[model samples]
Target: MSKIAFIFPGQGAQYVGMGKEIAMEHKSAQDIFEKANESLGFDIKKMCFEGPEEELVKTEYTQPAILTTSIAILSVIQQNGIEADITAGLSLGEYSALVYAGALKFEDAVKLVNKRGKYMQEAVPLGKGNMAAIIGLDRKEVDSIIKEAQDVGTVEGANYNCPGQIVISGEINAVEKACELAKEKGAKKAVLLPVSAPFHCSLLKPAGERLSEKMESLNIGSLQRKVISNVTGDYIANEKDIKDLLIKQVSKSVLWQDSIELMLDGGYDTFIEIGPGKTLTAFTKKTARKLKKKVKCYNVENTKTLNKLLTELG
Candidate 1:
């Protein structure tokens, strides 16, 4: 049986004015933004709808901003009767996925990510850490490059995004060295990402520890639907494992390619990305093509894209 997987994008996917149209058109979407404001005790909707870009991009603000926008869009998706057989997210996006799966409450998730963002940012001092995307290099090649770079400083593969794209993160000098090595190894491109912190690397382990402490106090519910974990790239069979998985995810490599492959192998042929940008959707396409898998991928961040996807799905 063909199934649908709802994928959510992580931190870097946020932007000003994301989900504005949908929030304006759909009451459910608007209610999410309102709820975020009430829960957060600030007007995140204003920042998202009219960002100064600087404020919206800060790791502290960016986490909840992206989460709220993604959930708002998710509300719209659910309102339209679109649902997922399984769900997964990249990095911070995992919280959104859990919330959608009924394993985490939206209010708790919003607050948790706020703290998570703050902790992650504090893990590494500004300008001391960096991340770079290596294109046209397989995971093994990128791993090798990161290992070689570790000779200079701490560098590790942070995200295995797809067949030919991997993100490495760690010390600034080490990341730069890795990028140079990746280019020398004939990678198509090795570009530094405009991110605030070196996320998903050992350098951020302190942040993970802190997040684990925070998670211990929260109440996680039973899953309404299976949600793939980024750390394991497998289905989380028990709700008891959610907290530990989320904590480990903070400082572990995001096995996005593996997660997508797992879904594909499980007969999920359609993917709908419910979030701010189309980054996850794009990655889905690349992963599907590389694996020679036929799948339909769509992103719903606005009314037009939502309508188009609804039509296609119908």
Candidate 2:
């Protein structure tokens, strides 16, 4: 049997009405959403289902909303008897993976992410920091470009998403300079990302430090499933290390491609992205193809995708 891995998406994947259908059709999913409202002391469902896009897009609101929706879908998946051998997620999505791995409680994860989002947003003022996706460039090339661009200001590679695709984040001028330098260096496309803050870059170290202090106060549980750390792109074995890894993840580059490669090399061939968007699924497929590995990819977001996953995975 092919081994299974459950992956979750990060910030940009969220949207209004993401979990509405699942919550309406699945009792387990609904209960998860209800629990989020109780723990959050706010109508997160309303923000997700009937969003004023502006409100929903705020980093503070977006993190919790995405985490709740992902976990809600995860509840339905668990109710169906589906399970994963290993799990991982993109930046904010890592919290969902940790919850799924039993390293943290749902309530605790939701609260932590809400605080994380707020801290990250406040780390750097808006318009002062930015991120850009450098397409059609290998890691070394992008790294070199970033190194050169650093002379202009503080910019560094943030997300090594997949083959030929990496994101850089830092000061706006530095990011723009990197994009221009990348284009001149034969990169196919260098597009500025639509994000509120320069996440996964050194600029967010202050946010990470605050998060570390908050994490030290929590009673994190032992993991039931292996979760790949974005900071290291490796299995996070020691429960004691989870807090530090999470803190470092806020500012370090997300080794998404490396994480997926590690799993695939370990003989896992199935990936199910449990979240709102197909972002992680798309990246998984691309990474697998680049690695010349045969893999199965699926995502569960709504009734349609859930039914398809059930039909196929079963």
**Clash number for every model?**
0, 0
- What TM-score does each of the candidates earn? 0.98, 0.99
Instruction: Quote the lDDT for 251 in model 1.
Output: 93
lDDT scores in order: 0.91, 0.93
Q: What is the C-alpha lDDT profile of model 1 across 1-314, one tens digit per residue?
A: 55899999998888899979999999999999999999999999999999989999989899999999999988877877888869999999999999999988999999999999999999999999999999998888888888889999999889999889899999999999999999999999999998888999999999999999998789999999999999999999999999999999999999999999999888789999988889888888898898788998888889899899878774
Error in Å for residue 206 of model 2: 0.9
Measured by TM-score, how close is model 1 to the native structure?
A: 0.98
Count: clashes, candidate 1 = 0
Residue clash pairs of candidate 1: none
Against the correct fold, how does model 2 do in TM-score?
0.99
Per residue, candidate 2 scores C-alpha lDDT tens digits across 1-314 of: 88999999999887989999999988888888889889989998899988988999999999999999999999998889899979999999999999999989999999899999999999998899999999999999999999998998999889999999999999999999999999999999999999989999999999999998888789889999999999999999799999999999999999999999999999999999998999888888899999899999998999999999999876
lDDT of 2 at 310: 93
